[model samples]
Target chain A: MDTLLSGQLLFAALVSGSLYALIALGLNLVYGTLRLLNIAHGDLVMIGAYTAFWLFTLLSIPPVVSFFVAAALCALLGWAVYEGMFRRLLANPGLAKRVEANSLILFYGISVILQNLTALAFTSSSRGYQYLDTVITWQGVSMTGNRLLSLGVAGGICIAALLFLRFHLFGWELRAVIQRREAAQIVGVNLNRVQPIIICAGFAIAGIAGVLVSMTEQITPFMGFPFTIIAFVVIIIGGLGNIGAGVLAGLSLGLIETYGVALTSPGYRSILIYGLFVAVLLIRPEGIFTKAVRS
Target chain B: MKALDIIFGLALAIGGLLVPLSGDAYLMGLVFQLAMWIALAQSWSMLSSTTGYLSLGHAVFYGIGAYVCVLLTGVVPFGVALAAGAAASAVFAGLIGLPVLRVQGPYFVILTYGLAELVRNVVMRIESALGSFGRMIFMVPSFEVLVWCMVALGILATLGAAAVRHSALGAGLAAIRENEVAAETVGVPVARLKLLAFVASATIPGAVGGLALLRTGYFEPAQAFDPVISFTIVTMALVGGTETVRGPVLGALGFTLLSEALWSSLPQLYMIVLGLTLIAFILFVPRGLSGLADRALGRG
Candidate 1:
């Protein structure tokens, strides 16, 4: 038990929590604003990771630069998805709800397409990068500099996101649309313009998170499944559509999972996470926080 | 009309029986597997379509039945094990459905999907439960016996769907599907009806899963609890037509044959094909094959 309280484990859990928070935040943003459960969100994360991997491996780009490039590419992809798929669905009055279900199938198909494409291009082997060589060791505890850097970056992103939503005009319009789509439309708020931006921003966040996660973990085409599941659980726990709650839930999950792994086998950690989800769902289906989004 | 329907049904049944006897072993196996899939699709439709609760985790029940049957056969005869597996799956369905069924729409779908993953992870981690090897298969029976078992299951599944579609419980389920609060206010026991549908839905899949496990003489966690199976079953139900007695069976037959053909020709692109097909069905034929048939036949 003493070994569990070591600074290394604590730092590791915090770092993992930061990354999980990033993933959860991406999911919450889309779910909150769009009311669309994008099952392809995880695939976006995978795409981001793959993009970064290719930039670093093929183009000889630095990790940090690759991360931004990956995020930008994902944002573009998100825009295309909205313009091509979701926009058409939203245009139809009767097909709105059906669109959500249909999108699951569509996105899942896209996911398969992307995964197979990656497999065809790169083969089904794991990949990694070793750009950051800094390591900090103190009092018999060691931690990687890259992890600390990712955590700091994630924190910065979260703060920036919150501020953007709080102060920016476009963010305000986005919120307005989410809160009352018809009212926003009545006010001449161009939903057609705003929705694509929101979707792009959401995908960008997920892509960045993907890049960050890949730094700490191995990159594989199938890595999105666990991320998707974890993010979904986090969003559900934090109260769907609430960004702050997602962060809290993600952090809590990270800590819980870290300690859970330390105490039990890694296999049992998932069960515990799911048990927490079921427990929360049974007790408070609305999640730990139910504050309405400012939108 | 009733006489014609009966005659057609008998002819179809006889055709299915003759396939195994006259067809090659591989072809017969494929036909049998198709029948099993049809049974699974029908069971899924009974719950998802009629109840409007799209469960993305139904493989949990199927896997449970398969695992239970495999385990129980050591202590009991094959027939008893099969029944036990079905009963056990029903019990599991009823239990899991309790908390989940409370949620509406997408929440229910997500929760069910998560629950299925949880079950899969639990099974994977608990080596003792599924054995260290992850799956265990029982000894296979003779081809004739296996054929009879599958035929009996197909008939039972069809009858079950027909019964559910016409029963008082079916009416209540339909009401709940239409509007839960309204159904509740109108004296329909919403929870009870859902639980009944869920449990009843489990019976055919459980039995068929057990039979499938016996037929293949092997089982694996990945094979038994694949999300693809759930997707395939739901797709068949939706593509064939949901909330109709014959829709799922028709869906199963069509989907399985399509899948086999695709797999044989373009194995790598089979899933992609399925995905595109699903997308087309969702976009163009939301009501599935039955709707298409109705349109083509000039029937309202």
Candidate 2:
């Protein structure tokens, strides 16, 4: 109980919360605008981590600078994916009802391809690199500088994303698409252009988050699916299609996880998280933050 | 065309049944996998394809059955353990069906996936707490016996899927799939039928899982509840053609053969090829291999 209230746990919760929000925002953005459930979202993150890892390992580029490169790569990949695969599916009005399921299956395939390809390339071993690992102590709390940096970067990106959605013209167009696809088209929001942008932005955000993850944790080809699941839980908690609430919900889930794990052993962590997800789903299918965006 | 399909399906089943007689270990093993996947995919198709709910959590039922059957094998007759596994899964389906089936679309899909992962973690924790890394089943049935059991299950599951697809329940399920609200408005017992299908579709996988554990002579929670099993089931159902019972059989046959061909030489490459093939199937051959067969034979 004492440990639960300690400043260290609080700091840890904040950092983890920021990470969750970072991962979930990208997934929510893609799903909100395009209705594309990119189960491969996590694999995108994995790619970003690997990108940073290789850049630092081979070329000695710091993750701070390499993340942008990785994010750009991801954005390009997203554009190609949209053009090559999802565009045809989305263009078919006859498939409107089954689009979600179809996209889910398509992305599941994409995930398999990405994971196995990464495994083939990287040999399925875990990889990590040290950067800014010096411990810092302040106000009765201490953490590695890398973790502190990750927290700041993740939090900053999440805020920038929310602000972009709230104030930017393209952000408004993206929201228009999310709220009502047909209505957005009627209002002259060019879906073909807006959709690719949303997908790219979504991938870039996940890429950035992946870079932060690599800073603080070990990564492997298979690390992405759990993050995908985490993103789903976060978006569900925050209310689907609501970006602002997604951040808040991500933070809340982080606290829940931190405190829940503190109360029990580490092994019970997944059970607790998934239990919360199932409970929220059964009790409030729309979301805990349903009124945030809908009303 | 329908009669031709039936004959073709019967021939394949008879051919599968004869695999054990050859006494070749490799052939029996491959046939067992074919039968196992056929049963799993066919059972999955019964609920997901007909109803369009698209469950990705079928692995939970399979895992639970394997766990229970493995635990009870020493305590009870093997047949009883298998039945107990099936019954346990049916009960689990019935219990979760009410709240689970309430949601629709992507919610239903993710919820099911999350629940399966949840069960997996729970089982993992239990195993660790019990200090059992993974259980090794002793006095397991012979390879031929296990393959025969799996083949029997495959036939039963295929028959059950066909029976469901043609029955009043199947019609009601199709209506629900077309539109749940309208189906409910028209006096269909939507909830009851959905639950029945969910439970029915769940039973065979349980028994099939038990047979799988026996065949392997081991039980590990991670392997038993792997989400890849769920993904493969969905892929096979979609690839085979979900509209008819014959789709799953063909899909299982095709997928198993493909995997066998590629797995030994290059496993990772096989997965990549599978992923690409699945993508191609979705984009171009949405109706699946069975649908292509239907068209080639002049009718669907």
Candidate 3:
């Protein structure tokens, strides 16, 4: 238990928490506004990781520079996904009642496609590179500079997103659409314009998180599903569609996982995540921090 | 139409029986897969299609059955082991169905997925702690016998699904799908019906899992509880059309055959093709192959 309270573990938790928060932020945005459960969200992150890896290995460009490019690529993919599949489903007025289930299956298809396509392109092998491997010690706790940089960037982006949602006019429209789609439309919110952008932003954020994750861990075509599950757990903890609360929930879950794994064997990681997830669903189906309407 | 249905059923039964007699291992393997999937997809429809609750954790039931059957192999008769596996899954579903089924829509989907993953991880941990990497069975039944058992389970599942569809229980479950509040108000016994359906849907998969393990002659926790099994189940049910008992049978057969054809040569593109097919089905043929057949027959 002594290790649970150690500064090193605390720093580890913060770093992981930032990554979780960034991952969940995009999922929250997409689900909040579109009502589509993007099971393929993590695959976008994998694409980002691969993007950064290729940029660094082939082009000799740094990951920091590739981050934006990966994000843009993911955003473009998201737009294409919406335009190709979701737009048709959303247009069918008769299918409105079944959209959630329909989209769940559709996104599942997308997830499978993305995973296999990436596997085909990348050979399903794990890939990694040396970037900011230097260890920096502070207050008797040592960590990689890359880890610290990822933490700062992820956290900073989360805060920026929250602020943007609160302050930006477009953010207001997104929140309006999230809070109440029909009401937002009644109030003249341009959903056609807002939906596409939010979906793009969601993918971009997921891509950014993927780049940050690549800094600290190995990347593979199949690495996306676990991250997708993690983001789902975070969003569930924070209350679905509550973008602001996702950050806090993500961080808290990070602490819980880090400390909980420290206390128990690392093999129990999935148990802890799924146990926490199931417990939350059973105990508070409405979520802990906010009563986000179960749309 | 009813006579044609009976003829179709008779022809399928005859084919199932004759396949094993042909003594072709590869063909027997394909038939076994088709039967197993038919049982699984049909069982899944007994709950998810009927009640509008899309569960993504059917693999949990299957894995549990496989684990239990593998453990009980030498200690008990094969039939008893299979029955025990089925009973275990039924009991497990009955225990969790109440609390787990409380959530609806997307929450239910996510919770079921999480629960399956949790169980898979726990099983992995237990296996490792016990110093067992994977279990190998030596005295399992022959392939022909295994295929016969699978065919029986498939037939049983199909009959059960058809019975449920035509019964009052089916009407009540359908009512729940249409509108749960209204179903409850109209005295459909919502909670009890949901649990019953969930347990019923789980039982055959357990038996199927046991038989599947026997067919493979090995059991690994990861392989037994693969989430891909759950995804494939959903895909088959959707692709076959969920509204009729015939749908799952059609879906399982079509998907199994398609996958069999594609997996060997285009292993890399298999999942990609499946994904694209799913998207296409959901977009254009939302009702699935059975629906298309119905329309062709002027019954739609």
lDDT of 3 by residue, A245-268 (tens): 889999998999998898887988
List A-chain TM-scores for all predictions.
Answer: 0.91, 0.97, 0.97
Candidate 3 CAPRI category: high
Candidate 2 clashing pairs, residues 3+ apart or interchain: none
User: lDDT by residue for model 2 over A144-207, one digit each (tens)?
Assistant: 9998988999999999888988999988998888888888999999988988988999999889
DockQ for candidate 3: 0.89
What is the fnat value (0 to 1) for candidate 1?
0.33
Error of 1 at B293 (Å): 1.8
Q: Each prediction's Cα lDDT score?
A: 0.77, 0.91, 0.91
DockQ of all predictions against the true structure, Cα-based? 0.49, 0.85, 0.89
Candidate 3, residues B181-250, lDDT tens digits: the string is 9999988899999999999999999999999999888999999999999999999999999888888888
- Candidate 3 chain B, run of 10 with poorest lDDT: B1-10
Q: Which candidate number maximizes DockQ?
A: 3
Question: lDDT tens digits, residues A15-78, model 1?
Answer: 8888888888887887777677777778778888888778888888866886788789889988
C-alpha RMSD over true interface residues, each candidate: 2.0, 0.9, 0.9
Estimate candidate 2's alpha-carbon lDDT, on a 0 to 1 scale: 0.91
Model 1 chain A: which ten-residue window has the lowest total lDDT? A97-106
Minimum summed lDDT over a 10-residue window in model 2 chain A is located at: A286-295
Per-residue lDDT tens digits for candidate 2, residues B74-152, read 8998889999999999999999999999999998998999999999999999999999999998988788888888999
lDDT of 1 by residue, B184-268 (tens): 9989999998988888888878888788888777767667777767777777787788846667766777777877888777654
